[model samples]
Target: MPMRLFNIVYITILCLFSTFVIGQTLEILPPKNITTVQVFNPQKNDNTAIIRLGSNEYLLFLFDDLEAGYKRYNYKIEHRNADWSESNIFESEYVVGLNNDYVRTYKNSFNTYKKFTNYQIQFPNKDMNVKLGGNYLLKVYTTNEDQPIFTKRFAVYQGNVDVGMKSSRYINPTYKDINQRIQTVISSGSQNLTETPDGGKLFIMKNNNWNEHIADINPDFTRSNQLTYNNVEWTFEGGGEYNWFDTKNLDVPGLTTERNFRKDSVYHTVLRVDFPKYNLPYDDYGDVNGNFYIRNNRFGNEYLAASEADYSWVYFALDAFEDQNGLYEPYVVGAFNNWEISPQSKLKYNPVSKLWENEYFLKQGYYNYQYVVVNTKNKRVEPSYVSGSFWQTENLYQGLFYYRPWGGRYDILMGYGEVNTRN
Candidate 1:
C-alpha cells in the first residue's frame, strides 16, 4: 500500500484500539434529541474552549434537550495525555475541590412551538478548578445514568510561550486562487526552554472543527526560543461562506427557508435547494463562520423555558446531477454535528428527485451548514465539491502549541492564536 494510505489505516486501527481502551473511562452517548451544543470561552466570541491555567477563566458549555421534561444533569472532568488518551492520574491530583457538580440552571421552552429544556454549565466554577495543564474532557450526564449524555473536549493551557499565526494566499500556483495557506511561529521569553525536535507537535483547525483538524505537524526550524512551521499541507481550501437559514419564528419563513408545515406530531420545514456553486464566483457575506446559535423568536424574552420551544424536521436538499462522481459521498456538516463527519449527517441521493437530501430533528433556531464530500477511499473530506472554494471566502484558523516537559507524561498547551483569511 502507498505510504500515505498505510499511515491512514494504521491511525484508524490505533483509534479503534483507543476506543476499546478509553471507552471504560469516557462514556459519551448523547441522545438524538439534543441540539445547539456549544463549548467555548465566554469572554471571547472567537476563542476556542481553551483557557489559561490558574487564571480566572472558564469554559462555557450549553445544550438543549428536546425531551420536554426536567432531568438532573451533572458533569465531571477527565485528564488526558497528548494523544487524547486518558491519563493515568487520580482525580485529586488535578482537581482542587469537588470533581463533579450538578447543573443547577435549566429552563423549559416557553411561548414556542417546540418544547425543550436548555441546560448550561461553566467549568472552573465554585465547586471545582483544574490544577494541571494538559488536555481535558468534560463529560455531561444525567442522574443514575450509566453513560454520559454527551462529552465536550476542552483544554487548560499554561501560557509559557507566545504564538503568532497568519493566513495568506497559497504559494502553489495551481491552488493559489482556491486555497489559503497558514504559517505559525512560537516564541518563548524564558531561556530555559530547549528545543525537542521530535517532541513538539502542532495542530491547526478551521472554524471550530476538531475532526477535520490538520494534525501531525512538526516545526520546520527551531532557534534559541523560536519555532517556525510552514508547509504546503497547511494550505486549506477556502470554503465558500456558509449557507444559513433562520427558524426563529415558526410562523414565518425567510429567504433560505422554503416552507414549513405541521406534521403528525412535529413540524416539517424544507430549506431551499442548494445548487452546485463551483461555476459561480465567490460572494462575500457575513455569516456565523459555520457556527450556530439557538434562537426562539416566538419567545419574547431572551431567557426561555426548555419546554416552551418546539421541534421540527428540517430537510436540507442539494441539487445533484448524474455526472457527479459516485465515489464521493456528501454529508451535511455544521456546528450541529460538532463539524464531525458521521453517519447521522450523511446525505442520501435520490435519483428520482434528482437531489441529495438529509433530514434533521432540530430545535427552532438559526443554523449554519455546508455540504462536504467525503472521499471513501482515503477518508478525506473536501468542501469544494458542493460549496465552491474561493480566495475571498472568510475563514478562521486556530493554532495550538503543546509542550511536554522532560519526563512529563502529558502535553501542556503553552500558546494559542487565531487568524482570519479576510484580515
Candidate 2:
C-alpha cells in the first residue's frame, strides 16, 4: 500500500478502536432519562469549560433527569493523560478533598409536561478542589452503582505559557471559499521553561466540539521559550452558519418549522427542507456557534426541562439534488449529540422527495444544526459542501498547548486560549 493510504487506514483503525473503547469505558451518556447535558465555564455562554488552574473560574455541570423527585446522584473526578486515558495518579493525589461528592444543588421543573429534576454541580468547590493541572473527567452516577451514567471531560491549565492566534484567508485559491487558516504562537512566561518541538502537542478545535478537534499538531520552529506553528494543515473548512429552529412551545411552530401538530397526545414537528444557495453572497447573522438552547416558552426565564419541556419527534429534511454517492455520507451535526457524527445523526435519502430525511426525538427548545458530509474513505468530515463555507462566518477557535519534559510522566496543560473569526 502507498504510505499515505497506509497511514490513513491506520488512523481510521485507531479512531474506530478508540471510539469503541470510549463507548465501553467513558460512556459519556446513559441510554435514557437524561437530557440537556451541559458543562461550560460559567463565565462564558459558550460550551467551553477549559479554565485556568486555581483561578476563580469554575465549570458548571447541569443535566435533567426524568423524574418528579431527586435521585441520589454523585460525582467523582478522575485524572487523565494527554490521550484522555486514566492517568497513573490516584484520586487522592490530585483532589484536595473527598473524591465523591453528592449533588446538593437541584431544582424541580416548574410548569411543563414531562416532569424532571435539574441537577447541577460546580467544580473546584469548597469540598473538592483540583490539585493537579491537566485533563480531568467528571463522572456522575447514582450512589448505589459503581458505574457512571455519564461523564464530562474538562481541562485545567496552569497558564505557564502564552498563546496567541490569528485567523486569516486560506492561501490556497482552490479552497478559498471552503477553508480558513489559523496561525498560532506559544511563548513560555518563565525563562526556566523549555518545550521541545517533539515533546509539545498542539490541539485546535472549532466551536467547542471535541469530535471536531485537530490533534498532535507540530510547530514549525522553536526559539528559546517560543514556538510557532504555521502551515496549511492548520486550515479548517469554513462551514456556513447554522440552521436553527425554535420549538420552545408545542402549540406554536418556531421559525424554520414547517408544521407542528399533536396526534394521540404525541407532538410532531417538520422542519423546512434546507436548500442552501451557495452561489448567493455570504450573509453573516449571529448564531450560537452550533449549540442548542433548551427552554420552554411556557415559563419565562426558566429552562428546567422537567416542567418546561415537551418531548416531540422532530422531522428534518434537506433538499438534495441527488443521492450522496461514492465516499461521502450526510449527517445532521449539532450540539444535540455532542456534535459527533453517528448513525443517529445520519440522514437517509428519499428518492421520491429528493431530500435527505432524518428524525430525532428532541426536547422542546431552540436548536442550531448544520448538514455535514462525511468522507467514508478517509473518515474526514466537512460541512463546506452541504453548507456553504465563508470566511466571514463566525466561529469559535480554541488552542490547547500540552507540554512534557524529557522525563515527565504525563503531559501538562501548559496553556489554553480562544480566538474567534469575528474579532
Candidate 3:
C-alpha cells in the first residue's frame, strides 16, 4: 500500500481504539465524596431501575454528597446495547427530548451531626424522555468542568413478548448441590426471532448485581413462536442468605448492632461480629436478597427519612479463620456499595483482635451484606467461599431478552421477567 493510504488507516484504527477505551473506563471511577447512590422506581419502593416503555412511571435517582453544600451537577443519558456497550445510533434516535439536563431538586440534611446535601432527579422528566427500549446509562457530572462523577445503568422494556422463568437446583452432579440453574422460555408471538441473522440474546442476573451477570446467551431451540434456554451455563452459585444489620434508630440498638454510642461529637455504631458460615448448616433467615432501604424509625413519616436521617460510622468485623493465612482478601459486598469490590469495602486484619475490621459512613437504614473472598493470585471473587453455598438457599433471578434485526442500529428490549427461587 502507498504511504499515504497506510497513514490514513493507522489513524482511523487509533481513533477507534481510543473511543473504545474511553467507553470502557467511564463507569469504573466515581467521586469519593459521593455516597448512597440509588436508582429505583419510587412507586414500587424497590432498587431495580426498570420501567415499561411509554409508561407514566419513572425512576428516581438519589445520592448524597459529603461536601455538604449545593453543587451544580448535570446528568446525560446514553443508550447502550444489550451487552452494556455504546450503541452506534445517534442520541436523537433514542432520546425524544434533550439528552442532558441539570439536576434542579436538592435538599440539605437537617438535625444531623454530619452535614451533607441530598440530590435527586426523576427520569422521563420535562427536559428528557427516552424513545428507545433497551439498556441506558445515566452519567452524572459537574456542569462547570464537564467532569463525570458517576454513572448508573437502567433499562426500559416494551414488553412485546412474554417471558417465563423456572429456577431449580437439579443440575449436573458436579454443581447440583452448590448451583442453581435458571431455565427460561420466551414467547415471541407473531415475531420470528430466527429471521434475523443474529437471533435474540438472553441475559440473566442474580440479585440485581450488574457487575456479575451472564450475558450473550442464545436460545437452545426455537419452535412454535417459543424460544428455550436451558443450557448448563445458566447456573449461579447458591450463596447463603445475606447477613443483615439495622440502624433505623440511633437511640436503640438494632438486631445486628452490637451497640451505638457518641464520640467526638459524632455518632458511631458497632455491628455484631460476623463469622464464616461454610461449616454451618443452611439457615433460612428471611432477607431482602442483598438490598437495602433508608428509614428513620424515630420519625413517624417515612418520607422524612431522606433529609432528616443522620450519618453514623458503622463498624464491621469478621472473625473468619480462612483469611488468617492471608491467601485471600476479604471484602464486604452488598447493594450499599453498588455491589462493587472496592478499597472502601476491603477489611484490614487486626493483629491484636484477630479480626478483619472496617468502618463505613452510612445514613440511617437497614442493609444486607455478605463476606466475599478474593483470591490473591488469580483475583477471583468467590461469594460462596465464606457464605457457604446451599441448594436450598433462596435467590432472585431476572432475565432480559433483546432482539435486533440484521440491519438494526441497536438492540430492543423485547421481554423482561423475574422469579424467586422459593416464592
**TM-score: which candidate is best?**
3
Q: Model 1, 370-398: lDDT tens per residue?
A: 88776666655566777787878898888
Clash-forming residue pairs, model 3: none
lDDT of 3 by residue, 1-423 (tens): 112111122122213221212346435346668988888677877888888898888998989998999998998987888877788788879898788788898999988888889999899898899877899888898863245788888999988888899998754565433467789999976778778856588877888876556776768888757899987666777889999999888989998999999898788999999998988999999898898888888784535777888888999999965764777888887888876666777889899999999888888998999987766654556678788888788898888889986778789998899999996
lDDT of 3 at 391: 74
On lDDT, who's better, 1 or 2? 2
Candidate 3 ranges beyond 4 A from true positions: 1-23, 144-146, 171-173, 300-302
- If both were scored by TM-score, which would come out higher, candidate 1 or candidate 3? 3
Q: Where does candidate 3 have its weakest 10-residue lDDT segment?
A: 1-10
- Best lDDT among the predictions, by candidate number: 3
Off by over 4 Å in 1: 1-29, 143-146, 173-178, 195-197, 298-309, 321-325
What is the C-alpha local distance difference test score of each model?
Answer: 0.72, 0.74, 0.79
Better of 2 and 3 by TM-score: 3
For model 2 the TM-score comes to 0.87
**How close is every model to the real structure, measured as TM-score?**
0.87, 0.87, 0.92
